[model samples]
Target: MDSASVYTRCQDRLLDLAAELTAEQLATPVPALPDWTVLQTYAHLAGVCADVVGGLVPPSDDTTTARQVAERAGDDLDAVCAEWRSQAPALLEVFARETRARYRLPALDVWHHENDIRGALGLGAQTLDADQLAHFTVGGLARGWAPDVPGVRVVAVDTGQEWLLGERADLELRAEAFELARAVTGRRSVRQIAAMDWKGDPSAVAHRLPTLPAPEVDLAV
Candidate 1:
């Protein structure tokens, strides 16, 4: 898939969403990332793009991401969104020129964060491309990182897609395409995963995910 295009589409929608928020909405805390307000989340998104365009790796570490958010602490929602837009062109160029799988990660991050922002604002799910999500989950995340689960058969009930994520299929995790992606990407807590449709034990792979661990608290979204 054209990851750069996906990134652009998701970014545009997110920015549009930001444009409609009230000051109170911007300051509202994201349940997915409780420590960050809606505006702070945008700051990180923009910061990641800036770092990439500037030839620096985007900050995945807490210290660096915190610094990114801190640097934009004074920026209002409009300014923060503008900063994110400013980096879009250059970042798109960077992503378009790449053949490596890591380039798709930014698109995935934006997609995930867009949903997080929406959920925080009490909005329903955005009509995003589930196919892109499926692509990212099957390639960039599950296959790319290769989690240490004994075996995982991920069945996306909403999309009718399935992926075997380990050496063998010993466990089946069935959920909506978005939920599956969210679960593996740290948006969902262990309790949330348990609440999903699972064959065998969810615990077998709940914590062994390759990306961020599941948060302890079940996010309201």
Candidate 2:
């Protein structure tokens, strides 16, 4: 689906969005990601692009990554935004050259963070390609995203896409394409996801999801 091109388009919009924000506004805390301000979030988005383009994610742990992003985050919002703008083309170029399956996480990372900025600023829903999202949702599930809920049959009613994950084939989740992608991307609240149509044990799968109001203890262990 040319995820790099999709990511570039989405990223250009985000950079434009950042250009509109004031320094004071950039410092304001984001509701969607309380631990980071808009500036830090912007830095993080840049950091991810830099890591991907440079292949320099040392330690390969969330804590280390967070520390690097936090350390690099600055009050110069325009410069940070500009940095991302400059670096993105190369990242997108790499993405374009790589295999489709290689984009599983980068596509999700950029897409989720774009929505993160959009959601925090109350910009409302951004344009999301259903087919792309559906592809990622299916891929994420197959990659053991929700391990406890083996046997999930997902159908996006909008695009009429289907994916059978796991061997059990007992539970089914029916939702719009974007919701399904957001659910798997660690964006949706637990309550919001549990409310979706389910043919089997909801709690079993719901608890397994990487969700919001995040767990207090880091379960990286």
Candidate 3:
């Protein structure tokens, strides 16, 4: 499947899973994501989706200030999620018609947030497939935090999956793409991955990982 297909499938799956949850279940605290409940997870995913869609429709000539963007997104969680779900069809339609290069948001943002929701619910074992994994690896490198960080190589210790980033001379790390993505995104700490025997310069590499914004709570319901 193409990148657009991959994105749509991932988004649909998340929506399906979210539809399965009860309000109470949505509010249940995710042990893995201590700061966020399932409801917050849904809101975050939906909010980010909306943000990406907004960015795509008319490509921004200049990046909007963070506060201004946040203001445009509003402080209401349910409103954001509702707006996102309502707007997704148009966004997906546009995405299907455009090339990856034309996409407004980085593909990694979609994949990572999908994983975030799944991970919080302990659904990783069920949701992510091999193809999605490959897409995520590429997306992570493409949307990596620092443009200046030398490209690093990743070797998944268990599965032996290998992918290259930046320059060959950069440090090589051995860990599953999922774990590496999580660590890079700050969902998981360096020490946490180290316990799993991931090898890398944690201090130097960790700082280059993309930072997710703070999650918003669902107060409307």
Candidate 4:
């Protein structure tokens, strides 16, 4: 599926899942985001869509994010889902037209958050469009985190897909694309990253792994 379709379908799936959840389930704490509950997470997602639709840039600052959550504090899953669905179509058009990675961020963000919500709800990983999107997400994260010099050569064993970031291919990493997507996005701990197949010392290139430090404990999804 295309990027727009991928994001649209993911949003639809999330809304469908929300429809099945009770208030208690919606209040479930997301392990990835300890400070936010499932409903809070949905609120943030909807807030982002609102920002994007309104032609405002999404900020990662704590104050802005906290405000986003606070604005929808009283909202339930149904309300938040409706808000997101309303703003999604406009963003979907942007996704379909923009070729730059910047425009692709929403698709990646929504997919990543969908899995986060799924995990907190005790749902298994959704594999529908995972394989198609995993490569892009993993490669983007790798490139974004990698240094200007030669750093890592990531090889997706499942699909034989390869992404050589930086100027040269020095450190080789072998793993499934989906796992690499999770790992590079701070879903895996540093210790877990070290456990993956590596041709060179993972610690040598640890600085290029993630923008923030990986989780201390394994976050099984």
Best prediction by TM-score: 1
**Root-mean-square deviation per candidate:** 2.2, 4.5, 6.6, 2.4
Query: lDDT by residue for model 1 over 1-221, one digit each (tens)?
Result: 67777788888898778778898998899988878999999999998888888876643678878988999999988888888898899998988777676666778788888888988888887646766676576545556535554677888887888888777888888888777777777878887877788889777666664367677778655
Tens digits of per-residue lDDT for model 3, 63-144? 3323323444434445645666696776776667766554634344556556655665556433344344544544566455
In terms of lDDT, the poorest run of 10 residues in model 4 is: 204-213
Per-residue error for 144 in candidate 2, Å, reads 3.0
Question: Residue by residue across 1-221, what tens digits does model 4's lDDT show?
Answer: 37787788888898888888898988899987788998998998898778767765533557867888999998877788888988888887766666666666667667878888888888898756666666776666655654655578888888888877776777888988777777777777788888889988777675456544577767776
Give the TM-score ranking, best first: 1, 4, 2, 3
Each prediction's TM-score against the native? 0.89, 0.82, 0.59, 0.88
Q: Order of all candidates by lDDT, from best down to worst? A: 1, 4, 2, 3
Clashing pairs in 1: none
Give model 2's TM-score versus the native structure: 0.82
Report the backbone clash tally of model 1.
0
CA-lDDT, candidates in order: 0.78, 0.68, 0.54, 0.77
Q: Return the TM-score for candidate 1, rounded to 2 decimals.
A: 0.89
Q: In model 1, state the lDDT of residue 164.
A: 80
